[model samples]
Structure formats: structure tokens, C-alpha cells
Target: MKATTARGTIEAGDVGEGRPVVLLHALALSGRLFDPIAAEWAPRRRVITPDARGHGGSDWDGRPFTGEDMADDVAALIETLVGGPADVIGMSMGGSTAVLLAQRRPDLVARLVLADATADYGPDRVQTWAERAEKAVNVPREKQVDFQIDRWFSPSFVEANADEVRRVCDIFVVTDSAAHAAACHALGTVAAVGELGTISAPTLVMVGDEDYATPPAMAEQLAAGIPDSRLEVLTATRHLSLIQRPDVWPEIEKHLDA
Candidate 1:
């Protein structure tokens, strides 16, 4: 369904009907990236997965946007469509947005699950993101796939899961460079760790030990900053651990149940 919120028209998947849970995808990925999560959760809870503006079926304003801006969009979504506060799960760039949502619009969030995400990407990291933004804007899509695959998965995982790698690579190749570049630039602006104390929602921060993009150290920092949050490190997985490792779901389910 399409939701006309403060951010504009958002294309979303609203499935099941119970306690609400929203899943946010990483940069360059649309709501489709959460197909597995949605399928699993839809059997019990109301699962909402929206294509963050500029990706998939959503409309982009054709300008640069920030994590806070996207968070506002989600705020409007839950308020106007979901009818109350909702649990939110975010990964990568989406996780940054979730943090912003909990900070800036606390009333809209019930709980937060930040997977393979960070609250701060320092100056050096910002420079790296800027370089990535440049590449996303200028490099050919075909060439970008390898770069993404290297950052998203470990070498062993890639060799063992060729089909999954290809599936994600297909997502990378078709992503809109301008949108991806804008998000990359937005990532440089994240600095939420300092204000994490203001968040009151129950928060769970998880990361893959092998995730180079947002390593376990980043998850540790996020957990330390958030008032009483917990951190879990999933071993033998890379950036996209949720999909790569199914065993983590039981732990995630326990968090949500709590």
C-alpha cells in the first residue's frame, strides 16, 4: 500500500495484523530486502516494510536527505497508518534512521533493533563514505557489485553462497546511483551516540563479528551509549547477518517478546 505522509508518498508492505513491527532495509536496498523477516513475522505480528524514499516503489524528492528526515517519514507512517507506536528494526543506514527516530520522535517508537549499524562514523569514516558516494555516482553499476559484495559478505561466505551473493549483487546493480549516493552522503552526518542517553525505548544492538562495515565494536559503542541496551555478536557472519544466519532469529524473537 501507499502512505502519504509528511515525507511524501511511501510504498510499503503492511502484512499480518497484531502488534506492529517495522523493518527498515540497508542503503541501496528496498523493502524487498526484508522478505524473509516479513514472511517470518507476518504469521504473528503486523509487519511493515516500506521502501525508504528513493528506493524501490517509493518516491524521492530528488534532493539530498538525512537519517532524521527519513525517521520523520517513519514517524508519520506509524502515526497515520499503523495507528500507534511500533517496534522498529533497522540495518545499516536504516539502523541510523531508527536511532534518529527513537531520539527525535520517541513517541513513535516502542522498541528498537539496530542490526549491523553504527551511531557514529567519525571523520575518517566520513571521508570513506564520501569516496563511496563518489563511486556510487560515477562508477558503472556492474563494477559496483564486487565492491558491495566484498563489503557485505566474508570471502568464505561468498564462495559458499554463490546464489545468495548473486541475488544481492542483482540488487546492487539495479540500485539508483543518485539515491544511493545521497544515502552514502547522509551516512557521514550520523553522530547519535552522544544523545543516545535520551532514548527510553528498549534497544537491542546486534552485529556480525565479521561485519567490516559496522563491526562488533560499533555495536558495543551503540549499546554502551543507549541507556540499558544489550549487544549481541553473531559469529561467522558478515554485514547481512540476519539473512545469512537464521539461528539469530530465536534471539531476536526473545528480544521482541521481552
Candidate 2:
């Protein structure tokens, strides 16, 4: 389904029937990232998977946007679709956006889950992100697959799941370069740590012990900052642990069902 928001037209997958559970995707990925999860949870919940602006089927006007801006876009979508508070689960870049959403529009989020995400990227983030953005647009997307995959999954998992890794790589290569750059810039600018204490919803912060992109240390920051939150670390997992290890779903389900 598609909804018009002040930012742009936001497209999403709205499936199942019951309380809504919004699954936000990672950078350079789309709502399709949560297809399997959505299907599994559909029997008991309404799953909403939206493509952040500039990714997937969503719209982007070439202008730069912030995590806060993306959160507001989500806020508008929730108002149009869910009509009230819903459980929000975000991963990677999506997790960062979720943090902003909970802080800016706490009323729209009943429960929260931040997977392999962070509130800040530290002092050198600006330059670091700018360099990544430059590389994203200048370097051919296909060439970056190995670099991205290595960071997203552990070596053992990558060797064991060739087909699944290929699928995610396909998505990564096809994503718009400009959009990817913009998202990189947005992530680099993230400094939501100070605001984490303001989130009122029950929250769960999860990360893979092997995750290097956001790292478990970042997850600890999120868990510690949020007043009502807990942290769970997945052993032998990497950045995209949710996909790399679907068994982690039960842990997320437990938090949401609570």
C-alpha cells in the first residue's frame, strides 16, 4: 500500500490482521527485507514494512534528509495506516530512525525494538559518512558487494548461505546511489544518544556480538540510555543478524508480545 506524507509518497507492505507491527529496513534495502518475518508473524499481527525514502518503491526528490525527517515520515504513515500506537521494530539504519521516532513522536510507538543500531557514530562520523557517500555514488554498486556482505554477515554464515547472501546483494546493487549517499549522510549525523532517555515505550535493544557496523557497544549505549529497555546479544551473528539468524525472532516476539 502507499500513503502520501509531507516528505513524499511512502510505499509499504501491509499484511495480516491484528495489532500492527512495523518493521523498518536497513540502508540500501527495502521493505522486502522483512518478507519472511512478515509472513511468519502475519497469522497474529498486522505487519507494516515501509521503504524509506530513496529506497525500494518509495519516493525521493534528490534532497538530503535526516533521521528525524525519516522518523516524521514514519509518523505520518502510522497515522494514516495504523491510526494509533503500534509496535515498531527497526534494524540498522531503520533502528536509528526508530530511535528518533520514539523521541519525536512517542505517542505513535507502543513498543520499540532497535536491532544492530546506534544513537551516535562518534566524532569522525561526519567525514566518515561523507567518504562513504562519495564511494557509493562513484564506485559501481556491484563492486561494493563483498565489502558490504563482509560487514553484514559473519564469514561462516556467508559461506553457509550463498543463496541468501546473493539475494541481499542483489538488493544492495540495485538501490539508488543518490539515495544511498543521502542515507549515509543522515546516519553520520545521528546524535540521538542524549534523547534516548525521553522514549516512553518499552524497548528491546539487540545486536550481534560480531556486528561491526553498529557493534554491540553501540547497542549497549542504546540499552543504557533508554529508561525501560533491555539488551540481547546474538552470538556468532553479524550486522544483519535478524536475517543471518532468524532464530532471534522469538526473542523479539517475546518483547513485542509483552
What is each predicted model's overall lDDT from 0 to 1?
0.86, 0.92
The TM-score of predicted model 1 comes to: 0.95
Candidate 2 residue-wise lDDT, 1-258, digit = tens: 787866679989999999999999999999988888998999989999999999998998899889888999999999988889999999999999999999999999999999999989889999999999999999999998889998999999989989889888888888999999999999988899998999999999999999999989999999999999999999999999889888878888889999
User: Among these predicted structures, which one has the highest lDDT?
Assistant: 2
Least accurate stretch of 10 residues (summed lDDT) in model 2? 1-10
Name every residue pair that clashes in candidate 2: none
Each candidate's number of clashing pairs is 0, 0
lDDT of 1 by residue, 30-65 (tens): 887877778887888898999887887789978988
Q: Which stretches of candidate 1 lie over 4 Å from their true place?
A: none
Model 1, poorest ten-residue lDDT window? 164-173
